[model samples]
Target: MDEFAFVDRSKTNAEKYVLRQKLFGTEEVMPLWVADMDIATPECVLEAITKRLAHPIVGYEIMSDSAYEAQIEWFATHHDFVMKREWLSYSPSVVASIGCAIRAFSDAEDEVIVMDPVYPPFYSQVRENNRTLVIHTLNQDEEGIYRFDLDRLSTQTSEKTKVLLLCSPHNPVGRVWSYEELSALCRWCEERGIVIISDEIHCDLVYAPHKHISTARIIPENTVMLLGPGKTFNMAGFSISTVCIPSQLLRDKFEIERKRVHWGDGAVLSHIGFEAAYREGRGWYYKLIAHLSQNAEYIDKTLSSTPIQYAKPEATYLAWLDCRALGMDDRELRKFFVKEARLGLSPGLSFGKEGSGFMRLNFAVTSQTLTEALEKLRGALQGDAYV
Candidate 1:
C-alpha cells in the first residue's frame, strides 16, 4: 500500500488545498480544514476508474444492481446491518440527500431538530428548505466528552418537529454514540413520530474501544441512513451517496422528491468506483484507520503542553480543539491560527454558536505533514506574541 503517502493536492481542484486563499483570506496557511484527506485514494478505487476510462466513449449512466448489492454486502459484512436492495436509493451527496428528505418528509415552517455544534450543512439544509431549525445543544463534561442533551431534546421537540438529523461517529466532537444512548434516542423519536436522517458517513472510521451503532439497527422503521464511500475511501469528487429508507412509505416519498428535483445517479465512473471501493477497499480502509489513529495520538501528545486541549476523537479524522483557555474570541482565534500558526482550520463558530471557542482540524494528512503542522502550532503557541 506504500503507506498511502501524501499526495500534493494543491495543483488539483481539492477544496481544502486549492481554495485556501478564498476561504481563509490567505494561501500561506497549512490547510487542515475540509474533511477529505491529503492521502491518495485506495488503489482499487483508482484502478476501477482507470479501467472505465479505457472505453472509447462516455454516455449516460444508470446505477447497476451490482453496485447496490456491493454496498449491501459491505454494510452487512462490516457493520452487521442487513439491507434490502429495494430499500436503497441514489443520492448525489449526503447533504443533497438531507435536503431531499427535508422537503419530502416535512412541510415549510415545519421544525427539524439538530444537535448543535454539528456539521454546518445540518444547519443550512434545514434553513434553506424554509423549515424551522430547532437546536438541541450537546452537553460536554469537564473531561471534554460530549453527550446528547436528551432532557433538553425532550422539551425542544414538539408536534411540529418532523426530523432529527443525526451524525453518528459524529464530526468535530467525535463521540460515537453508544448503543444505550441510541436506544433512548430512538424511543424518544419514535414516540413523537420524528423521522431520523442518520448521517453515518463516518461510521467506517471509528477507533478502538468505541463502537459505532447505526441508528437503523436500533430503529430501522423510522430511520433513513445516509451513507457513502466518499468519506471512507476519499472519493467525494465522485459525488455519489446512498439513502437507505427501510419504510416503504418513506422510501416512496423520498423517491418522489428525489425525482422531482431531477437529482439522478452519478456518472459511469462513479458507479465503478463505488462498487470497487466497497468490495475491494477493505484492506486499505483498515490501514487508513490505523494511520488516522496514530495522527490523533500525535495531536493529543503535542497539544497537551499548550493551552489548547483536545479530546481524542472516538471516530472520524477531525479533531476538535478547545481554544477557550486562549481567551480569544472566534474572529481573533481564527486570525491567530492563520497569521500566527500559519494553519487554516475550520473555525468552530461555523459549526454553530456552541462551537465558538473551538476549531476542527483535519488530521488525515501524511504523517510528515501532520508532524510539521503540529510543530508549527507548538511554536506559535510558545511564541511571545501569543503569550
Candidate 2:
C-alpha cells in the first residue's frame, strides 16, 4: 500500500500539474489530464537507472539483446504471445512508429483508417503525413460497451487505403478487443491489403477478465505492433518504446524509411530502465492493476447516481464519462469540471466529434486523491445528484 500511496508530483515538474493553468486556466484544480500514473515508477526500473550512473561515459549506445529478450519472456508469460528478436526494432515512442510506418508503407494521398474518439495522435499522424484520413466511427451499445463496426468500416475502405491504425485494449473508451474481434479485423485488413499499425501501449494496464490481445499475434506478417514499458511501469519520462515488425518485406520497407529519418537507438539510461522493468516489475504491475481496479470501482460507485454516467472500463485506468445527461455542451462540460468540480479532465470532443458530451478521467491516482476528486464532483452537482 505504501508503494501505491500518493507521492506528490507538484514539485516534480510533471506536465499534468505544470500545464494545469495553461490547459484549464486554473492551478487549483486536480490535474488528472495526462495518461501517466500518479504512482511512482517501478523501483526496479529506478534502481537500474541509478546504477547505470556509475559509468562515467554517457555516449551513444545500442540497446542490448537482453532487453529484447526480457520483453519477449514477459509477453510470452503474460499474453501467451511469442516474439522473435529478428522481428523487433527500437522506436522512441509509439506515435513516432506510426508516422514512420505511414511513410514507409503508404504514399501521399493514400488513405489511413483511424477510429473516432481514439487517442488524438492517431488522427493527427494521418493528416500531417499528407494521407487521406478515413474516420471509422465506434458506437456504444445500450449497456455502454463500445464496439467497432467492421461491415461499416469495410464499406468505408478504398483501394487507396493502405493502413489501419489500431488501438488494442483501446484508449479513452477501454475495450480489450477479443481474439475473435482481432482475428476478424486482421483478416479483413489483410484481404484488403491494409497494413495494421497497432498501438498496444496500454496492454499491461487492463483489468480482470478483459485480456489484451496483441494484433500481431493474430496476423503478425500484416501487423506492426507499437509496444512499450512506459505505461506499464509509469516510465514514459524515459521515452522508450519499440516497433515489432514480423514480416521481412515490411521490415525492409520500414528500415529504409527509418534510416531516411535517422531514428537511432534511444538513450543509455532508458535502455537500462526498459530491460529492468520487463525483467523485474511483474509483482509490482499486478499490484498496480489491483489498485487501479479498486479506483475504477470507487468511481463507478460514487458516480452511479450522479448526473454524469460512467461504465467501469473493462480495461485501462481511464474512465469514459458520459456527461450528456448534464445537458451541457462540450465547452460548458469542460468549464463545469474546471470551475465547479475543481478538477481537470480531458475534454472528450478533443478526441473526436464522436466524443462530444463526454469527459475522460484518469483514475490511476491514489485512493485518497480519487475520493477527493469524486467528493468535489458530488459537491458541485449538489441538488442534482440522486440520493
Candidate 3:
C-alpha cells in the first residue's frame, strides 16, 4: 500500500482543513487539530457507497440486520468481545448516545463523573443536559504517563453520581486503560450503582506492546460501550456509530430516550459504507496502523533532543506534547505554535485544567506533511527559518 496516499482536503468543506481561520484565527497554519486523518478513505468504503448509489431512489431506509452482524463479528474477531445482535443500537454519534444515556438514566441535577482532561464533549454533554458535572482529574506519573486516579475517583463518587464516562485508549493522553485498571474501575462503579459509558472509538488504533481491553468484556452488565468506525476507518462524515448495551433494562431506557429525541435511522449510504468498512477493511486497517506507528516513531525520535517533552502514545494518532519545559503558559504555548511554528494544534487547556502547558498533535497525515510540520516546529524552537 502507498502509505503516502495523501488527499488534499482543502476546499471540500472539510472541517479540519476549511475552518482554520474560524478555529485558529488564521488559514496559514497547518490544520492538524481535528481527529480525522488526511489519508484517503479506503477504496472498499468508497466502492460500497458507489454500489449503493446505483439504486434509483435514495429514500428512508432502515438499518439492515447484516449491518449489525458485521459490527458484532468485527468486534468478536478483533477485540474478543462477543456482542449479541439484540445488544446493538444505532447512534448518530458516540457523543449523541452519551447524551441520550445521560438523559435516560439520570435526572436533572444528578451528578455525572467524567475523568478530567477527557474529550471536551464529555464536559459539554453533562452540563447541557442540566446535570451536575463532576470532574475527577486523572493522575500522571513522573514519567508523564496518565493513569486513572481511582483513589480520588472513589472519593468523588456518591449516591448522586449516576454515570461514569470513560475514554478507553483515551484521546489526547492516549492511555489504553489496562485490563487490571478497567477491572478495578468496573468494581468501583458497580459497587456504587454507577453506569459506565465507555467510549472505545479509538480501540482499534492501538499500538504494539499495549493492548486495548474492551470495557464491555470486563463489565458488560454495568457498562454501555460505544464503538464506531469513525476513528478507525476515518468515516466520521458518515455520522454513524453503534451503542452496545448488555442489560435489557438499560437498553430499553436508552431506546426511549433515543425516540424522545426523534433520532431516526441512518442513511442508506452510511449503512452500506459501515458494513463494507467493517467486513473488508481489515487489510487497509493494519497497513494504516503500520503507517501511523512509523509516523509516531518519527515524532518521538525528532523530539527527543528538544526541550519539548512528550509521552509517546500507546494508542491513537494523537500525541500529547508537554511544553512546560519551554516555560510558557498555555496562551504563550498556543501563540508560539501558531505564530512561530505556523502549526495549528489543539490547546491542552481545552481538555481540562490539568492539560495546561500541553498540546495535542494529530499525526495521521502523509509522512511528507508530518515531516514538514516537524521541521517547522524544529525551526521555531531553534530560532531559524522554517522550511
Off by over 4 Å in 2: 1-3, 383-387
List candidate 1 stretches off by more than 4 Å: 384-387
Give the alpha carbon lDDT tens digit for every residue of 1-387 in model 3: 347677888869999978899877888899989999999888999999898888889999998999999999898898888899999988989999999999988999999998879889999999999999888888888876788777777777779999989999898799998888899999988989999999999999999989999998898888899989999999999999999999998898889999998879888898999999999999999999999999999999999989988767899999899899999988899999988999999999999888999999999999999988999999999988553
lDDT of 1 at 2: 34
Give candidate 3 misplaced runs (Cα > 4 Å): none
Q: By TM-score, how accurate is candidate 3?
A: 0.98
Query: Residue 69 of model 1: what lDDT?
Result: 98
Distance from true location, Cα of 246 in model 2, Å: 0.6
Instruction: Give the TM-score comparing model 2 with the true structure, all chains together.
Output: 0.97
Q: Rate the local accuracy (lDDT) of all candidates.
A: 0.90, 0.91, 0.90
* Local error of candidate 2 at residue 94 (angstroms): 0.8
Best by TM-score: 3
lDDT of 3: 0.90
**Per-residue lDDT tens digits of candidate 1, residues 1-387?**
236676877788878878998988988999999999888889999998889899977788899999999999999988889999999988889999999999999999999998889999999999999999998888887776888877878888779999999999788789899999999999989999999999999999999988888788899899999999999999999899999999998998998999998977778889999999999999999899999999999899989989998878999999999999999999999998998999999999999988999999999988889988988888888773422
After aligning candidate 3 to the native by TM-score, how far in Å is the CA of 61 from where it should be?
A: 0.9
